[model samples]
Target: MDIWISKIGYYFLNVGIVLVYGLLLGAFIAKTMARVQGRIGIPIYQPFIDILKTFTKRQAISHGIMFNLGPAFRLAGGLGTLAFIPVIYGNEMFSNFSAAGDLLLVMYFIFFGQLGMALGSGESGHPYAAMGIGRGLAQMTAYEVPFTLAVVAIFIQYDTSSITEIVAAQQGSIWNWTLFTNPLAVIAAMIAFLGMAAYPPFDVAMAPNEIPIGPPTEFHSHFLSMMQMNRAIFAGAKLILFMNLFFGGATGLIELVFKTWAIYMVAILVGAAFPRFRTEQAVRFFLGVPMLIGIASVLYIQYWAQ
Candidate 1:
């Protein structure tokens, strides 16, 4: 009973982290991105506060009931991804039962959130939103292959499926850190991350002038607010996951928060300063550069000339 309770607690905690990261960092990303464009930044908590205000305000437009379920399950997907990562400080929230599952599970679970939102957007009856959503899906395809290869390289190098084991393997050693040993992986992952995070170069999905709100054209009130929160948490969580995997986990919450903040800053600044990519161009860039980088990571990991 005690063991079960602890696992439940950790699950909720992980879920909370996922949500907080999204709410805080999503706003931070938007603000920083704005700053890069020479605009004054908003408060870091702007998104959260905005969400609450929006929810309380009027006009909860529903494109259909289907749109409602998208955000609901989309959130579930994010929390589920975090829960499955198995890279928390010690054991995972679900490690007691499924140790074999690792990064693969994390990668797969994320699609749930992304795809759910995508479908919901298509149902929104907004042409711009549909166009953006379609482009976003295409963009996802462009990057996912290289990203998978980069992950495969890590799995091959470590020969393990457990994220905890992978982290432990790198413990107290600089050489073991994939970022140092596998710069190719770093490049590939960064490209994919930027794409996944949907920054300037890859934000065709929500191209402000083109798509407006993209899939969220009709979403307002609580639903839209939740969507904003989900985006924030997903980005922040990814920052932590990437850093912990490549750079090493922090000794505690403070270092963790601090490092993740720095990571988020880099991401947001880059997003803001850059211009949004043309859909075809963005896809080509990701497919080309990331594939090369991913292949290099595999070679370096497996047959580095050392």
Candidate 2:
């Protein structure tokens, strides 16, 4: 019982730390983009304020029961994803509940949240919601092709399904990291990450100008707040996951922040430089070069990896 309590305590602490870090990271990116474009941008603490205000306000509108449940389901998915993956590779306290096949579990949780959101939004009777869900799911499906292929390549190269073991394998040196060891998979995965990050050229699903903010168009007040919170948590969790898979996993919190921040910059910089793609264009883009790279990674692992 004591052990379970301690684990629960540690898990909450981990969540809190990542939550703050994720919010700040988003703010920093927003500020950076604003300055680059000659605007003052959002304050660093604005996300906290927005979340707090939303929760305190009354949500007078409700589409239905599933509408009420959508944000909760999304938040649960984020937490569920984080719960199973080791945060810091060597520290049991921060490791959460990682086990064999956790990588697969994390993937499922990632999809589950979006599916729940889709169902909820579908319940809302919003035409834009339905259109957004269709586009989002199609794009998601396209990106998942490359992302899953990259995962398969990693699994083939690492010869283990455990995320902890994958991190352990990368620990000896920087060169041992999959970024160096499996550049093909890294390239493929990073391309998918661009879409997963939901920035320019691939953000058609939630295009504010085009779709009025996608599936959550009807969600407001606490529902929006919960989704916002989950957004941060999910983003942070994905960064950590990618760090463990492609880069050397961090041994300490400082290292974790630095590595994840660096990984995030790839998306931010690319987003800054590119324009949005049409839904069809984005889908085709992922299915083209990124898909080919993913395939090559798998073939390389099978035929040449040592």
Q: Best-fitting candidate, measured by TM-score? A: 2
At residue 82, give the lDDT of candidate 2. 92
Which of the numbered candidates is closest to the native, going by highest lDDT? Answer: 2
lDDT of 2 by residue, 74-170 (tens): 9999999998889999998999988999999999998999999999999989999999999999999999999999999999999998999999999
TM-score of 1: 0.88
Q: How much does each candidate deviate from the true structure in C-alpha RMSD?
A: 2.8, 1.1
- For model 1, the local distance difference test gives 0.73
Per-prediction TM-score to the true structure, in the order listed: 0.88, 0.97
Q: Model-by-model lDDT, in order?
A: 0.73, 0.92
- Model 2 stretches astray by more than 4 angstroms: none
Q: What is the lDDT of residue 41 in candidate 1?
A: 84
Encode model 1's per-residue lDDT on 1-78: one tens digit a residue: 997788778777766766776677667666766787799888887776887897787777787877888888777676
